[model samples]
Target: MSVELNKTLFNSRLKLIKDAWNNASDSEEYGSIADVGAFLVMAGDPAGEDDPIRKGTAFQQIKGGDNPIAIEIIPQAGAKEPSNDAIPRFVQAYISHSRVGSLLKETHTGKLVKEWEALLAAANSRPELVEISPAMSSFMAVKDDEELKIVRTAANLTSTLLANYIATKLETILDKEAKISHEDFSAQIEARLGSGEGDDAKGPDMKVWNKNPKLKDVDWGSTELCYSPIIQSKSTASGYDLKSTAESSPDMIAHSGVFLISTGIRYKGYCANMGRTIIVAPTKEQEEIYTLLLGLQADLITNIKDGAQIRAIYQHALSYIKDKKPTLEKHFVKNVGFGMGLEFRDSAYLLSSKNNRQLKAHMILNLSLGFADLVDDAGKKVGAENATILTEGVKSVKDTLFFEANDEEELKSSKPKKPPVKPLTNGHSASPVKNKTVAGKVLRTKTRSAAQEEVLMTTAAKIREHQIELHAALQAD
Candidate 1:
């Protein structure tokens, strides 16, 4: 597919974001000063193929996992207990109640409504197939094979657009602001691509939206305002004058952390998951911390065996980091690995017990670890990553190297920054990182963890138990 068509998917996602933003805000909405509005609704991982989530409804129904609706999606709004994550109510309503219009087949709503009513009745009455509107039955049924391709195309296109944006502009965005034009950017990207599932898939030939006379098309959804701390927009001068503004705000720090959680840009149906932490202006201490964390991350990824006990990875990280800072282990900790697919946090936390679950092959996961100043991010003991996954292979974030355009000046005018061999420093806390290798791609190794089949069998059982509970919960009122 041409990059332009992929951008079209982002354009639609932008519309959806704008709609949600208007729903939330009543004040001047010229990019809302911060990207909080945008971030909350940003896409996580896409729903699995087998997952019943065709559109936004599944996110509403589950209200768990990384499905934009997850309680931990954004550490909960106005939350006093930072440890307790809750899905925002407005977000929930918009996703579930309102998005039914966006996600379900637009032409099939009235019938879907009737079918929902019918299904409600059937659920209370009987499980046997009963005569019903085709829309409802189909909605409740597995997605048609054709629909899957279209939706997947739509989604992958979005991911490609967002990934390109992040890859090309992420650093510039973080350091400075830029004019973002969803319309122009979308048009540019989608114009060339065709619609399909693979990287080379073609985007829709014509505009995929409607052209009726009575109503404004608003056919595709979109983002809230494409606002990031460093602007990543593609707007025009006459339409929306662009600016590249960068500043430090408490909001930026807190939300940037959250943004890192959902860094993979949302598009079409397939979601992307990637995150990186860059200290805007790093102190000597912060630089050291980044080095240590990056090194520890390397160790974690290298040790991720297909069947290794979950606890073993944790122990390796903890012990290795302890080799650097023995006393650092005294502080609180989170999960080191987790499954990633349709959601960011898929059925696990960063600090999960190996007794509860074990790593497995073919599971896409984000193995995260966060360290604080002998404390946490919030009053609740500064926060750090709490998850990783047990998988045979690893994906490196540095596979596509990004160099700051301004990095030339920074390097020429400044001292040559030496990277830490490993993040194992003793005693006091090392500072946070200014530049980072996001996820496993930061490392340049192809080593895999040892076989851990025994632990895998046990963890699989626990996952099954959790999944059964989840399915029942979804079926519940």
Candidate 2:
């Protein structure tokens, strides 16, 4: 079965780009708009196929590998005909004859960089034609309902694959005294993804779009991974640095120690991310840190809402970490979370100390919070690579989408009362209240003990105390 392209979604996105172009052209801040022609040009495949700007503007996927393709969006003044819609007319794709076959002449078969250079030359000659890449990035950061649904589906697939891998295979693999390579683990994951069994067989057959040729008859489901599976064990998971390539040494997955598995999958051009740090034979410090990390992630989710400033959110996480475990502050990843949709991470809406953009409804975020460089009682470097003792999945913010926070009072009033502290048989805290919408479903707040809640409330109060200062700092930016 073939996947149908959502033309309406693409059309609405095109309208956003066109509107941004017109707004920029009219504004004096961009420069003189007299006779200058502004064109949004993006190269494909080995060049810019994965570019969010191109993805947002072009409805159809352009598969350009050795023979790359380029797309140009020129904003027109008005529709030539009375009834014809002008949005579709603005987009023009330039695919090379090598890729498109002999129907079209081989006019643009050269390097995509040269084509881009030519566009750059034209832009340099004309001052009014500003680079609208940033504008496009900003516009595409917030997803619409249809886009959210696709991303949610992709996220659900990833979650299922990850859950299945952990439940069925991880223990057996980790239990064996024999060495297991990262490639072996990654292959296992790929097998599950491409199994084409049961519900997995329902969708179009998966294809890695960038590496493979464009399907002639139908759009194949894109399984091109958003990033290489991160399978780091033992000392490898001790630090914050990410390993994309497979480790050269064998026995990457040790019999004991912490193991980190971060993986993402792409479906129909959109991406979803999920990660977990598995610990086998974890030390007391490792388990404590793991539980702490989970709690921090939960607190971060509770604070997230529409209209919240991205930087402020980061500050909140930072402040919470500092108040709870100051030593781990250095080990924490620089970014708390980021906006994700067409691209794995939308740069325009990064949840960093520097970004001041407000979070909006329909925005999906990958909330990443973890520690590294952990030391044991004797100060030995034993990483939380994989822990099986507290094997309950850490409720970190994976692929989460926000819904409209139109009525704060209503939301506050509807907040479910905290249930009595009931520990699970597995010794994990009971599931918390489901108050927020995420990934097209309701996401619950992380469960916290009375003491932990007291600490969090104290931290929140402290943050509230500095709200004015934080607001001032943001305004200064």
Candidate 3:
């Protein structure tokens, strides 16, 4: 997308926030039923992280510099006319002049404080500086047409990178004789994005967990680039606590076993998360668990819709897992997913029993579902013990649109297309198969070894079957 188009979209986003503030002012929930509206101040993240409120209203390119950037939205009586083609007239951006070459660059820190104080003093009736963070969250939960387009693009880019570049070349990249180090492999992925393969938007770094049990506690210093890729191959994925520093062990990619790659790219400040587990030489138990998780994920996605209670959806997922695989119930993640947009994880609409928010149309969701601390039938820990799939989707009024590594025909067509299921001679269901083309080129080619090829083929078949099942479920709904 062009910069001009992005500016126009930014205007639309600001307008949404402005309208949200006005709506909150009229409602009794914010204690503004008296028709008195106060100035809403949104502060930027001081650490220059991806702040939802600031980025949602203003340009995505703008960030916290020497000082915290602030945006003040004063509720106007009537719909104000746009002063320019870019920024909405209601938004007053306070950015430092040092942020040169930035969108909406201005130096209004001194004026912002003075105006805020003066407005408070001049009002005959005291108006409360109501916390509008809730309003902002509500406004950002549902994406507009422009934002959705960016998110879709980001999703496609991520799928293409993972399915085409990474998966296709996995055998060669992780060859036992000439295995690439975790850090080097991460760099290659980054280099692909830097070379016009993906957007330049900022978000969480790419995570490459090779699933090696040896380097579980190695903590490399944080002297790498701001978006340096995190490489860990321990029993569990790194940053599971969501507060620890992202560190990668100086370990090479494992020669065989489960390799989990969870990554996403920020396109125009919108994030798209895609995680896949690649089992080099899988065991029967490994294949069964992966297929089971995929089916479970498909069921969860099918149940998501607009107007559904967030907690209800989560509970449904929990019940589905419990009923399908009683053993994996305790291993399921606490939260199924959460709203995603300008910020990587939007806390306003978390898909958890503790949250009371309802799913709204046009809401972008990142569904992270899987079983951790996995074990085999022999009560022994297995490779890829922490099996998880992090995929994104957009919630619609009727059916949700999940971003997947499938052909365009599968994605665009609503009709349920029967997959070619070749039954085994033993009268059992066909084996799992990986996706043929993820966003474009063939995912698995003849380059892989025969055993590896069979595994991927089975993986692709299972993906297809689940997709067909998902379509059938949607049709039934």
Candidate 4:
């Protein structure tokens, strides 16, 4: 399709999400008072058959049938106490449950009962709108019509807030170093959401956005994580992105400094993953490095085609650079680009194993291929890469990842662009990482809990087994 059509579709999808937020379910429609009342009385319904107390009379009914896809929500008074819900928001175990159960929960029953149970038990708040339910979590975990809206909304919101953060936090960082603390900076962003830090506000448990290091520190400002490995968007750094929280763990979280990346924005339960690499003044080396990384990303993504073999794409990436030159290896593209939703890197893994898997219909994958070269620079390196979606007829997911460089007009126009070839070595800067973002905390991120790593190893084994099965089936045919 034409570039105009591609952009038009992306904007349209984004607008729908904003509409959903503007028209969220109101208090009465959510049946908050009624849901709370019913649960309370189930414990003790003393009123015989017609007990007025047994049924909720506190709220009015919302007219339905008149409106399809009706959603109800209640903005209860800020909770005096934040209840603990034993939901597994970030556990790897839940990843195993996604495939079939996710589809079932959408038009049928939900997958995580424990998460929903938490809300059912929060009676003290008399919270007409208790959380800890399948609603928001389901949106994150599943990719359906409604869920897609949330993701698109989140992406747009992220860019909007990013301007505010860049002006308020990052842009003024070195100049106002003594004046701004991390906590103060974070709260500023919170306000834009009609939410902020108070004694009882929710934790920044936005796991899907994939928190980076700047969020985890106090004295140091951080960069935002652009392009989660799973979603496959290009990064401001111009280098490819790091993969899942499950993979990076505490080891990677240590490097999060001046994180210019963003968790995008959240609408209802859905959120988008947007990020930028944080840099101070522009150096000739820095500028050149950025161009190289970004150019590779642009070229590779635009070339994506029908029946495109993974190995062919892999070879094309390597060809861009004559030498190894921190080459775009086949393994990087193959292993990254997963399904986007509540969690990062859900449903799919990008690489093919022993079996050569072809792209299927409606599968959204992140082709997060990026690289850095230490060539000719004194020492510092840079990165560039992005994500694109594969659909039979719809526009590519690449539209969402492209930005005209909000304020970098001079840089945009001025370019002979660098030579495509650079030395392939371990000399350039290291790749980006994702995991354990603690804002204002002094301690280091805890290493990957051995338990979680064990689960990952087990998952790896299962993938191997599945590959064998696929290979056998393919061979039989």
Alpha carbon lDDT at 132, candidate 3: 42
Please give, for residues 271-389, the per-residue lDDT of candidate 1 as tens digits. Answer: 32333443332334444554456556545655564565666777777787688867666541445545433332343323354433444433344455655434324343332322211
Best by TM-score: 2
The CA lDDT at 189 in model 1 is 39
On residues 25-73, what C-alpha lDDT tens digit does candidate 4 reach at each position?
4422122222221121111222232222111111000111112221233
| Candidate 3, RMSD to the unseen true structure | 14.0
**What global local distance difference test value does model 1 have?**
0.34
Candidate 3 TM-score versus the reference? 0.58
- 10 residues in a row with least lDDT, candidate 1: 468-477
Please write out the lDDT profile of model 2 over residues 230-259, one tens digit for every residue. Answer: 666664433423433333223456655556
Q: Which of 3 and 4 is the better model by TM-score?
A: 3
Q: After superposition, how far is residue 177 of candidate 4 from its true place, in Å?
A: 4.5
**For candidate 4, what is the total of clashing residue pairs?**
34
Off by over 4 Å in 3: 1-36, 43-128, 195-231, 234-245, 376-477
Q: Rank the candidates by lDDT, best first.
A: 2, 3, 1, 4
Which regions of candidate 1 are displaced past 4 Å? 1-164, 167-262, 265-268, 330-332, 348-351, 373-477
